[model samples]
Target: MVELQARSLRVKIAQQWGSLGLPFLLVAVVILFSFLSPVFRTQFNFLSILRFASFIAISAVGMAFCIMAGEFDISVGSMMALVGVLGASFVPVIGGFAAVLTTIAISSFLGFVNGIFITKLKIPAFITTLGMMFVFRSLAYIYTDNVSVYIDNDFWLYMGNGRVLGIHFPIILMVLCFVGGYLMLRKTPFGRYVVAVGTNAKAAELSGIHVDRIKIAVFVMVGFFVGISSVVISANMGVANPGLLGQGYEFQVITAVVLGGTLLGGGNGSLGGALLAALILGSLRNGMNLMQVSSYWQQVVTGSVLIFAVAINRLRYTLMGQEA
Candidate 1:
């Protein structure tokens, strides 16, 4: 029995390691480059990386939950824009915390509607979220009048720029968010239900899981996170410009989530991996800029990495199936 248990432990360890090996390898590459570049470890560069990581990391945490719950929300980019606009407009009237809460509440409502369409109406998640993405973008533009609104460095604004130990407040908040998210996904019954629902919705339902409720919860959670991200990011930038603020955010968040070894098919994800992947991407981008890589070249490199990473995941799953 001891030998049997030892073998099982070894296999489990190997499987976990295997899942994360690619992203770790990518990180190793960045570390190697940092050694060659004197600029990589500078305080400025490090803070810059954190600033970038905080924005995407917040959204990725929510994305992780949604993916684990057997759904995806490509609409987060637009949702971020929505939150930014709402927060900027409402903060003056309602104060920072209240304004933020109100915006998140609205975002959650929209997400709940999406969930109803997905789970109750039997609409596909990808299609519904994609459509909502456009709708939100349009709403953001119309509501904000395609203009940027700058806050008066008030409470809402300060949250993004405030610092502790030379790190921005948003970074601290993002770390807290990750810690909270990790607990929710790993230490709670909701975590089990998330994975169970993702793996087999019908089976989970038959086993007494409230699958629809779980799906709605996941969407609402995702919305709240996206809203949180928008609040921090818009403040950091000193203003909100929907067109510029949220441009390509969905791609960035999705890229980080998938690169972190989250199963694209759902039912598996890890905050540790997501955090690491965010760092890796931030480092790579910062490193390239230091190396004087052109913006077009940066896009090429980023795109290539995402494509190759996803392809590798697919191949890994295929081989596992064969081995089984």
Candidate 2:
């Protein structure tokens, strides 16, 4: 009995490590990068890495929520562009504060529409969101007339650049977003509903859980985060260019979330994992830049990482005798 108990304890420890494979991988990546680049451990480089990681992590938090609800929002990239363009357009008329408010409201409404099409019109989320992506992207171009809209407001710039207690405001906002998302998913009944719907939507509906409403709420939540990211991106760049803003953002955010152990078919997710994965990705990109790697190679490396992560996820599920 003593031997059996010891074996059981060992198995349990192994399982815990298995569940944390992504985080372990992140740590390994950090160590590798630290060895590869002399500047990787510098304070300035660390803060820079954190800033980029924070942006990706904030969006990944929303993406994780959507994936956990068994849905996809490919429109996130275009949504950011549209929000930036619309907000820039409003700045000259309604002032910066109101423009930001209106932009967020519009983003929320578009997200609601994406949910309505998927839940009410019986469209697949992938299709709905993919179509909306192009629609918003086109609208952004038309609205901006193919030109960059520059906002010279100090407040808007501060949202992206201001530091509090030596930490960037965007980094603070990112931490707040991750903490709030983690708490909601772990402590709230709505969070349970999200997991339930993702685990089995039909069963969730049969259980009298408003699955559609929950799904819509999830999409809206994603939209809110994307809206915040849009503001930060535009502010950081000092201009809102429909053509340049949020390009390939959806891919990066989704990659971070998936790398964090959020399954594609969506039964499970981990906010902590997502944040760590985002940091890993940021570190990888920064490290490559330090190494003077080509931009094309960076894209290839990122894509390869996503594919490898998915394979690891599949193996993990299979090892645990669970369907991915």
Candidate 1 per-residue C-alpha lDDT over 228-320 given as tens digits, one digit per residue, 9 for 90 to 100: 888888888888887887888988998898887678777766777788778878888888888898989998988887777667656655544
| TM-score on alpha carbons, each prediction | 0.91, 0.94
Candidate 2 — which residues are off by over 4 angstroms? Answer: 1-19
User: Would you give me the overall lDDT of model 2?
Assistant: 0.87
lDDT values of the candidates? 0.83, 0.87
Off by over 4 Å in 1: 1-23, 315-324
- Per-prediction CA RMSD (Å): 3.0, 2.2
Q: Candidate 2 lDDT, tens digit per residue, 247-273?
A: 989988998998888888877878888
Among these predictions, the greatest TM-score belongs to 2
